[model samples]
Target: MKIVQISDTHLTAAGGPTEEGFRLLVRHLDEDVRPDLVVHSGDIQVLDPDDTADRVRSRELLDLISTPLLVVPGNHDVGMPGLNAWAGITVTDARVAAHVAVFGPDHWRHETDEAVLIGIDSELLGSGLQREADQWRWIEDTVADLPVRKPVLLFLHKPLWSATDEPVDHQVDVGPVARDRLLGLLERIDLRSVGCGHLHRYRQVRRDRAIEVWAPATAFLAAGEDSLPDGRQELGYVEYTVEGGEVTAQFRLVPGMPQITTDDVPSIAQAIEAMTALR
Candidate 1:
């Protein structure tokens, strides 16, 4: 099966170059790839989690996909815990429920002919809430019953671990506390690969014997050390093909995609300060 993965679109309510690029990407997918399924890793909208307008526009863009589609929540989608309201908007149960009301559930499992695809919300991984515990239990149960012959593919908004030796950075990946438990649970399953986004740049890493593929943002250029080695901030998506029990990935760059420079991702302080000044 051919599956196209797109993440971190970061669409805003006001249509602009980013949206145009996404439109062009959709056209390319419809005309060129024509894959069997499309999966959006996360960050469907821009910053403000309460902005229903942004959600509406995001939904519209997603609706443009003619192929089978799946999605999971990102930090931007359900509100990142601890830092959720630091930017003046917290991730209440209502906020997460709203995503389900518009899109489907925040997490799900799909068993394809070749593999088992599991999606989870990265923001909730280390939250220590009842929901987090519930998801953990669900995951354990899911893995136990899965067919051992089929490899499992996991989807989330953040990487399980950036580098094996690097310390955990909650901002960039799953926190250590949750990561340890998650890795333990996953080791029991036949995990083949993991797909995630949030870094806004394409990268591939191997951790815990699973291939981790990071998808680039479709909206803007990532300005940071996480950029491509050649210093070219690429903007594109990832396409995966599962055939004969083997999986392969391809990063497809969108032609003529516009880019802009930013100091870095907006911090909680920056977002809060901007909101206060507006008030």
Candidate 2:
């Protein structure tokens, strides 16, 4: 099976370079990289979780891809959990429901003859909401029942850990407590890879028996003050080839898409300013 992972699109209804980049990606997928499936890791919207138009537009645009697609919610899509959520837009049931209305379930499982693919809502990890607990239970049950020999590919918005061996930064990675809980549940499966977005960079690391792949943002690049450590801050996506219970991943970029920065777009800059000003 061939799967493509695209992340942190940050698209808007108003349309801009970011949307153009996504269109380029669609063209590439249709004309060049014809993968079996495409998984969008997150940040499907420009910024606001309450903007119905943004969500609708994002769904409409994503439908352009010819391959089967699965999407996981990002902080920008359903808001982050905990007190330090960006712009104080914490995750709520309403926000999650809104996302589900447009993007299907926040968590899903796709199984093929060769592998099992799972996507969970990273935004719900530490929220302490009832839905969070529900998702946890669902995840445990789903993974627990998987065939032990089937290679598992997990996808989410935030990464399980950071680039360095430092304390868990909730902003960049999953919360420590939730991470432990999730890690424990995943131990039963033949985990092959964990793919994520949110960092706006492309990186891959080996952890125990699994590979962690951070897919780069298709919308813009993170540079200078906004950059994260140890990852290539490029604009692209990831393609994975799964065969005989083994997975091989490669980073890919569309030829005609422009590599843009946050500063190059006023809306993105303003959104960042608003998020930072709250701190």
Candidate 3:
């Protein structure tokens, strides 16, 4: 299954470079790869609106998505809790409703002749505590029922844990409660791999028998000078090919756009080859 993962688009009602990158991404999906499915991890919008809350503003644009986009919301996409009210935008379960109206919902399971992909929403805005608890139970139950021998690709916005040991723009906010619950679930399931996007930079960590892969931000990146020549998050996507219980991938940055994929940018084929060795 050639499933693509794109994250952190930061699309605003007033689109700019970020929006351009999004269009580039959409074009790549519809033309280049024609992935089996496209999953957007989070932060699709910058969330600045005149009347409604930032989350709503972002969803308004999401409604215009040209492809089958599955998504979740990011902290920025929702705007800081209190800030929304002051901005005349309200943050509530309506956000999830709005998201579903545009990009589909919190979770989905798809199986083809190739692989089985299961997704979860990390964005818990409306009905916070209750929603999280419900989703947590569902995630565990869903994993528990999966066939271990078969490969299962799990998708979520925030990572299960830290992306790396280094300090970066990302943080492990899953908390002990969320972390423990998921780890416990993993202990019993044969999770082929997990893909996430909250952290802007690409980082991979392997714990237990599973690989946790963080998809890089689709929007502008933070500097990666000494360690990164691109110095920008650089827009990109994660493409996965799954067969049986084994998975191989290339976390490819869209290669053509000079503004996004530059000379330093890793080619799609190269990126997948790079991560193949990692797996």
Choose the strongest candidate by TM-score. 2
Q: Model 1: how far is 226 from its true place, Å? A: 7.1
Model 1 is weakest, by summed lDDT over 10 consecutive residues, at 260-269
Looking at candidate 3, the ten consecutive residues that score lowest on lDDT are: 79-88
Model 2 — which ten-residue stretch has the worst lDDT? 161-170
Clash pairs (backbone) in predicted model 2: none
Any residue pairs clashing in model 1, and if so which?
none
Per-residue CA lDDT of model 2 for 108-205, tens digit only, reads 99999889999999999889999999999999899879999889999999998754455443478886798888898988889999999988888888
TM-score of 1: 0.88
Clashes of each: 0, 0, 6
For model 1, the stretches where C-alpha displacement exceeds 4 angstroms are 83-89, 163-170, 226-232, 262-279
lDDT, candidate 1, 66-93, per-residue tens: 9989999887788776653334444567
TM-score of each: 0.88, 0.96, 0.73
Candidate 3, residue 245: the lDDT equals 61
lDDT of 1 at 143: 81
Structural RMSD, model 1: 3.6
